[model samples]
Target: MARFFTLEQAQQLVPEVRRMLNEAVEARAELEESQQEIAECMRKAHQMGGVDLDTGRLVLLRKRVDELGKKLKEILDQFEELGIQVKDLNIGLVDFPTKYRGEEVLICYQLNETGVGYWHGLDEGFRGRKRIDRDFLDHHEGDLVH
Candidate 1:
């Protein structure tokens, strides 16, 4: 089942979620860099007839890529377990599902933001974010069954 979050509840998790998001973003970048380096090395080796290449460095890069992939996966799994949706890894954008006026909406957060102050409909996405105003505050709700 999809877990819903109130603005306050989502705000409370920002600190920890920000840390994890940063870690995951960094790991993803490192993973991409390592993969690119390995590809370049392979390309050079192919062009040079597979001679005079730094195989040791290539092996190390491969290992680093594997480690980074595992780390990224763990971070993503944590997000899933928390019921947070990762929108953009590069900018560390995420969404917390919530109900506004009894309709599903998203509480949006991005890296460097101080708190969760904006929201949008499921189809609106980040581009359509609107500041959480008095109307939204009064109507938005989290899980009610519990």
Candidate 2:
């Protein structure tokens, strides 16, 4: 079943969720960098007549890339287990799904924010966020995700 979160519940989860997100984001960057380094190493070897290759260095790079990729995937799985939507790893955007005004909507938060303060309709995304306020809270209903 899909998990739902209330504004208060989502806000309360900021600290832990942010930490997880940061770790995932860092791992993601490292994984990308690792891939680039491996590619560059191979390119350099091929360019140099495919001889005098640094096999040891290339092997280490590949291993590091695999490790970083595994770490990234683990972090992503943690997010899935938590049931929060990871919208953008680059920007650290996440969405908390909950009911407002008898309709499902999303409460949005970005990496640098202290707390979630915005929400938007299901069809409207980040660009459509509106500030969370009394009206929004008053209209909120449904079971909150743990």
Candidate 3:
């Protein structure tokens, strides 16, 4: 039998998942900044014949870049650990696919909110997101691994 979740329960789970995704976004931003810095350093090094008094600085920059890369990986792993797969971010919502009730459900989470109160069928659009009800939730509860 499939177990269903109440709106309150689903709402409760959204906060932690959202937090994990936000952390991943922050990590990605940091990684991009680190990459830009590394590229700039390399550009400068090339301009200086690949060996200059700033060689030591270049080495440090490379190390920082590597660190940022590792951090990004770690963040991504953490996000996955939390069962979040961010597929898109537009306006203020982050869209992703998640399992619910033995089926793949498209969930859209508001970045500024705590709960994922909106979702839709696999082939449905935004308007397809029906209000979560007891019967629907019950049909899919057994599918919730988390």
Candidate 4:
């Protein structure tokens, strides 16, 4: 069975989650910029008769690009482990599978500071989040396994 969290609870956790996602996205952007620089260097190298000042610089650029790629991969892996999905590179959102009662649910972070209290159904809007029921709250309080 899946466990459901109240919208308020979910909201509380959003700020922290959003911060993490933002870092990941920034790292990815850096990686992309590194890749573009490497590509441009390679193109310049190829144009210079295959042996010139630009060729040596291209080698260094390639190495830097490789390092950025590794860093970006690590960041992405971390984000995945945290149940976050990169939708808009500019905005971070949590995309984790959750459960309410016995039903599967999808919870998203709105970057609010309410802590994991807000939640919506798979097909519901943010306005649809309701206060959790007593039974559900009790189950969570007891830390019961789902």
Better of 2 and 3 by TM-score: 2
lDDT of each: 0.94, 0.86, 0.61, 0.57
Residue 145 alpha-carbon offset, candidate 1, angstroms: 6.4
Error of 3 at 109 (Å): 1.2
The list of candidate 1 runs beyond 4 A from truth reads: 144-146
24-110: candidate 3 lDDT, tens digit per residue: 667567767767877787888788887644667767767876876787677666655545555543323444455566676766566
lDDT of 1 by residue, 1-146 (tens): 78999899999999999999999999999999999999999999999999958999999999999999999999999999999999999899999999998889999999889999999999998899999999999999996433
Summed over model 3, clashes come to: 5
Q: What's the CA error at residue 19 for candidate 1, in Å?
A: 0.4
Candidate 2 weakest lDDT stretch, 10 residues: 137-146
130: Cα error in model 1, Å: 0.6
- Candidate 4 on 1-146: residue-level lDDT in tens? 33343444445546666676667667767777767876776677678855644656667767777776777677667656544443344544454455666665555554433444444576764556655556544433211235
Give per-model TM-scores.
Answer: 0.96, 0.92, 0.62, 0.58
Candidate 1 vs 4: which has more TM-score: 1
Clash totals for all candidate models: 0, 0, 5, 23
Instruction: Identify the candidate with maximal TM-score.
Output: 1
Q: Pick the candidate with the highest lDDT.
A: 1
Identify the superior model by lDDT, candidate 1 or candidate 2.
1
TM-score of candidate 2 to 2 decimals: 0.92
